[model samples]
Target: MNERQRARRPGGRSARVGAEVHQAVTDLISERGYGNFTVGEVAARAGVADSSIYRRWGSLANLLTDVALTRLNARSPMPDTGSLAGDLRTYAANVAREITGPDGLAVVRLAVALSSMGQQGVQARDDLLAERTRQLQSMLDRARERGEHAPDAFAVLDHIMAPMYIRVLLGIGPLTPEYVDGLVDRLL
Candidate 1:
């Protein structure tokens, strides 16, 4: 195979390179907001040639979109505790813990900021929200199948997640277990 073909091969090194690039993207965004960095900086941080990133991600916005998608995909799988209340509580607790962490909060903040820019941001935001919505809906659907009188998935999801996002974005009160319990109770 030619050098270009070898370079494009996916394997351990490619996976490592992708992970490093993603980590660098998150760290850079955390250190210096989303709008202030360049692909060259990310390339340097990832210890890869700038052309590698360009070849892989195409552009800065595309790279950021991939970062957002990767962040969302890395979250723990949705819980299944046999009961809607139990599931909601578990999900809320997990989300609360994540949103309060430095890396998680940085990803969330950057995704939100990027959503306002243009097409790439909008696509990333949509993909992220869609995945989240799908997970919540799946949990609610399982509850419905198990004879629980669940409300509309989207409405229930809004009630549960909106407050969490508010806290994450606005620096509101802590996401205590009591708070999650209250939200779950109110939803159910």
Candidate 2:
């Protein structure tokens, strides 16, 4: 193959492997949870070698982290509505749908279970949470620029997101649109 062909080939192969591995990780976690699966299992399921997974992700924890991060990012896009309330409502509704969905719920459970394993696991959990917070902060900054109630980004994120996450995590209440609307109403 020519040089350009080689370069393009690697990109396609790398993307395919990454997608396969990610799907494998999620499927294994969904089937047996995080604590019970092995990297070998993931490799076999993904149709890639174990060494390839290790070379790409370094460890199972890292792989799981990548899976969670990728899935979350793909599912939860930052909202860009014209108003703060509109933005918050859209964001909250998206989050509610994700957390309540099967894939999202599975990832959340796997992430929580993986956190106690070691530093890698803990870092994965922290990283995912940080990314979520960062997205929220960005939305808040946009709202602030639009002359909305501009509280500290972190503080406002905590106030708005904490209860929604808590309700989902604890199974206390449903993350309904009405509930999210009320939260946005109270916040804005």
Which predicted model would earn the best lDDT? Answer: 1
TM-score between candidate 2 and the true structure: 0.83
Residue 82 of model 1 has an lDDT of 95
lDDT of 2 by residue, 1-188 (tens): 65434423555787888888889887887688777888999999999999888777777887887887777777878889888778878877888788776654665576677777688788767776788778878888898888888556566567667777777778867777788888778777
lDDT of 1 by residue, 91-115 (tens): 8788788877766566556666777
In candidate 1, how many Å is residue 188 off?
1.6
TM-score of each: 0.80, 0.83
Positional deviation of residue 138's Cα in model 1 after best superposition, in angstroms: 2.3
Query: Deviation in angstroms for 109 in model 1?
Result: 1.5
Tell me the lDDT of model 1 at 53.
Answer: 92
